[model samples]
Target: MAPLRSRRRRALAVPVGLALTASLGFLPGSATAAAPQTADAPASAAEAGPELSYVVNTETGAGTVGKVKKAIAKAGGTVVTAHDRIGVIVVHSANPDFARTMRTAEGVQSAGATRTAPLKAAGTTEVGKPEKVREPRSAAALAAARASGQEPLESLQWDIAAIRADKAAEVNPGSRKVTVAVIDTGVDDTHPDLAPNFSAKQSANCVGGLADTGKGAWRPYTEDDYHGTHVAGEIAAARNNVGVAGVAPGVKVSSIKVSEAETSLFYAEAVVCAFMFAADQGIEVTNNSYYIDPWMFNCKDDPDQGAIVEAVSRAAKFAGRKGAIHVASAGNSSFDLAAKSLTDTSSPNDTTPVERTVDPSKCLDIPTQLPGVVTVSATGPKALKSYYSNYGLNQIDVAGPGGDKYQVPEAPAKDGRILSTMPGGDYAYLQGTSMAGPHVAGVAALIKSKRPDASPQEIQWLLKAHADNPGCPTEPYDPDGDGKVNAECTGTQHINSFYGFGIVDALDAVEK
Candidate 1:
């Protein structure tokens, strides 16, 4: 099965003599196997089975809530919450037949369980184990940064410099009024670098498809699941002079935890709640660094996959309509999303995966392909496509520095992976389109901060209009230096698959 991007790290040659940290989560070119569940889910339920989560999608503009509620009840399911405006209903039921029965009910367009595992499934999957890295920076690097009035680790941030974020900060440090919601795993608000700018009121844990506003519930369980924290740090870590700074250091950030606590799976219902929460809270921008799990690509023709896509697509569009701009990663598989056909061996990741060839047009990568969403691809220090970043002639909307350890840029940036805050206030280097999406999001936040009255559509336009169009590489694209061609570039400097309009430009975003 193709491993999910979040769980994978880029392969790079470790500089000799660099001491390895003890907890290196996974090797440079490898991934840790998904942790096994603690116990097997019951094969069959007793008279009263454990409650399972389901999502019921109603036709748009249909005033069918009353009818849907009755149908849910008749199917032995209890309504958890209803996003009536978007026509999505979250439910819980012990009856295995709940989805099948609800499909026949009036006003219900499609209904399906959100997870393959039963609700009673126990145990947790340990994710984001720390990877090997050189020991903490020596006093020399710190002294150099301090002498230059930069953050302690700022010199290592080539990604920021690639888009001239350092220069943009001078133009406008951004405004506190703009909040970029990190809609992934969760954020560690207590990190010293993030504490000054974290927005608690706008944060929530939507792991079970319902909003959990309990105290501190929006934070990740631990750094082991540090994907969200890393993405958050990339967007809005404070310019506190202590740790590394973010692209838009002056903006506020909110944590909207959508991935399941143990499995790290981003289910459809959780994602639905996340977008809705961002909209209701008046968040101006949101960064989606991961795709919905179990199914890597959801085809519209398949009933189950169709429901998943329909429900989440409506929720994302609803967020856009409510004035929030959504930006997402283009995936890390390096496949051409605009291609006619591709092989997908890793899907239904929650269960056994089977190899299947899918038509990219019919099999949509939700949120990324959904209308009004800005799809971001990853570029390395040398301004080339990150070897693993997915691209397409028409799929990419923008490019950003996601780091390529093997394709290091120049002096000061010894490593190619993007560095950001981890759970315990520590920092780590990681790479993927997951790291690239936030660069655009942070730039989007800067745009919103500058034009506070602009609509989401207007902001999206400004984002593309103001980007720096660095055309595709003139030479054959090959980061590994192997003779074989990796991927081909098509289109002009204005538009292409590796980069949509162009690479995101922080300086242009905040400029008048």
Candidate 2:
């Protein structure tokens, strides 16, 4: 619908962070790349060719891992890192057949290149930048905000009130013991609002299949890398009377930078590293705003794409087993994910996109459609499904305020987009399912704080239980009022395609 409006902003500027020359070894906390076992061979791994990154998933065990690494070495590939616990190995090689060769290793379950492009592939596309938000001009609202214990910029945030986060904070600001990880482009811990609650110890740069937890490793590479910072602000910006307060302001937040510096592409290698690092660190939650790149939808039937899905799914499953709950955006294409077949024109985003028809049932969006993730859809201030949000009867778990340009707020707040912290300590407006995922992550963090001992599955159950469903719209679901229907809402009033179990409620998370 409407040319598939997936707003994953990227720049045509000089690309950085794609040079994968890091020495081989498991990072202190993170291990190999995430999952799969086969692909036909084009050439032997020993033959020199363009450098590419690959993940080799194998049977878990020291013996199995050793045999796999030996196989990787014999195939003329360098071991970027090997995760013995999960049987995933991040390998780099100029050998054209590294992935195909590894698939034959005795203990290997799956193997495939993480990208169709070379090691230093650059993005050829560009997206519009986010708009910088100014202070609300109403003096009466400013005075009221100051008097009501709201932060300086809190008056500009209608999203907090939309999900009753403002009221939830008053009852309980949430426990700092719970930490949610923003697994995206880097985060700026220096922002005044985020600095206080940011957890440096848990943060790292998981770029190019390696995790670096050194001081400031988690900071954004450039001012334009603001997605993670905006996401962090939405989840746990401090309550101190500085800027806008977060939904769970008292909880701690960490950053696991997975996107390439300028291209802002999230390759599978980086994604796997981020998930493994977060889960190993005992992180309670992770917010995944973007899909695993190269492919928008990784089909399990295709050998290479299948391995990409398996790698990501394995890491996500491991995180769940390790007590980390993942919250991901339901996507912005506005397609019915439950539909039988859909046309996809964005596969292999790293080099060039090739159009292909795919079945939603088999061609899944990684991590988002992966089992055990709290898949969130976007909603506007009016408590309606956002025009850009993807929906399916049983796919969406909950809805959150991701903002909408059409759903303008009242006097105090002017912009309909979600207001959040940018890199250089500035505030801006960005609207997408990317923004929506953090809200769900924040609410889940609140649940973790209140229940302290609950498992990931239990926390997910609580989220669906406490949500306030707005059921499918009784009238034709057209926000623009155009004669043509923008999107059709399906399912019963209680749990439908658009609102999932309904909009998330922060107040009930603590009280219930």
Candidate 3:
């Protein structure tokens, strides 16, 4: 199966999300890098050689970064920025042995390069160009939609009504004080629907592992980077009699771009930067619609994967402690996350993928599977699992309206898909866990708006408490027209693999 993340909003036939497949030429075993040099090696070995990106994880404590700054510099690495709170430092170095030398430095826990390719490789490569084409809605449909207390294109948004967002808006349109940070590709703050409530102060680009707070830094600059803008609209599109309305139309939205311009790849240091930025900026909720790129499952036993898991886990846990409720997609590969053993062929995506059998419990899908994070599964308009949504009893915490073209929601929305703003001030219909995660994030924001003093844990409990639990279906599962069964739902109403705690309820979140 392809290891796509949840943001590849191209051909519906192609899976959304980061692809697990790798160009065979770059496979881990097939390729090699400069081995670590001895401490007594030539002085030139520690001098500047090739500028690379590295994530330096320091020993947890105050002054951890300061303690190792001299050592880092001696290794020919320059500190780009450091999250002293989490002990993660982003560095740029030309030394081939920067990571190796830094690892032996006092007060440094772990250090590794964030990508397989050099820092300059990303700029030269092109990836993740949007391929899907959406047709404009007929004038008659637009007119009829406006007549029914909806925006011109709102009639196509069954997702808004799926969670009863329209009713919730009547009761509570959310609060500007509560912000939902879109930690994805990038957001187009210029979109009319998003501009009204966009929080520029809270936005930044963490593309190269360091946060860039310049103007428009949070907006997508590459082709097909509208995924983040789409997610932002899903959470807090303006309620002004405009094109569409979000779940919490009044809540503020901020963009935190973590992916590269073309690849759409999210590296470990970049993720660490995003969480640290959100925590410091008082972002109440963060919507993580894509997985950390390259590896679908980061096994703790693997040194490289383990270091990434450790660094990102520290960042995520710190964000939670600082009061940001992280909501991430459960991925779109349809793999049962709770299974015992699974074969995964796509990994190290920047290079090549090698098929390997892994125990699901030992392999983790970061941020989503991390502790304290609310993992979300996707449901179509029919409230069934999206054909591509991955499910597991222990993995899913809630469900949301992730459109499925096969089983459309209700009338007024002819297509079975989620409609939201696109880049360049347009709109499109897209589906995936990428879409569903934002709905839950919006609802979380609404809950925060209602209870401003509520802690992240309290808001999490409220989300589960306010959800509408639909028991597992008794019928056999077969989403596609194929003759074979596709999935099996198990568990009770309160907790299940298919629907999780249950479909998120916006109305219940605000009123209950």
Index of the highest-lDDT prediction: 2
* Candidate 3 per-residue C-alpha lDDT over 23-76 given as tens digits, one digit per residue, 9 for 90 to 100: 122222112365554434522644435566777889767666787887887777
Q: Report lDDT (CA) for all predictions.
A: 0.76, 0.78, 0.77
lDDT of 2 by residue, 1-512 (tens): 01112634321111111111101121100122322222333335343566888888889999888878877887767899877777788888766656666777798888888877778764111122466655543677667767988987787789998888999998888887899999977889989999999999999999998999999998888887777888899999998877788999999999998878656778888989998999889999998888787677877866667777888888888888999999988887777899999887766666667777889888998778999999888888788887777889899999998877667788677666788888887787777788888899999999999899999999999999999998888888887767778888888767899988989999999898
What digit string (tens of lDDT, one per residue) describes model 1 on residues 1-512?
A: 11243322211111121132311122100122322111122113453344667888986554588888877876667888899898999988766556666777778888776655566463111112334334465688678777786887787778899998989998997899999999877888999989999999999999878899888999997666677787888899988877789999999999999877667778888999999998899989998877776667777766567778889988998888888999888877778888999887766566566678889988887777888899888888888888878889878888887767667768766677787787777777777787788899999999999999999888888888988777878988878888878898888989987888888899989885
The candidate scoring highest on TM-score is 2
Put the candidates in lDDT order, highest first.
2, 3, 1
Q: Against the correct fold, how does model 2 do in TM-score?
A: 0.90
In model 3, which regions exceed 4 Å deviation? 1-35, 40-51, 94-101, 123-147
- Which model, 2 or 3, shows the larger TM-score? 2
Off by over 4 Å in 2: 1-47, 122-128, 136-144
RMSD of 3: 5.0
**Model 1 spans > 4 angstroms off:** 1-3, 6-51, 59-63, 122-143
Model 1 lDDT, full chain set: 0.76
Candidate 2 Cα lDDT to native: 0.78
What local lDDT score does residue 476 receive in model 1, on the 0 to 100 scale? 88
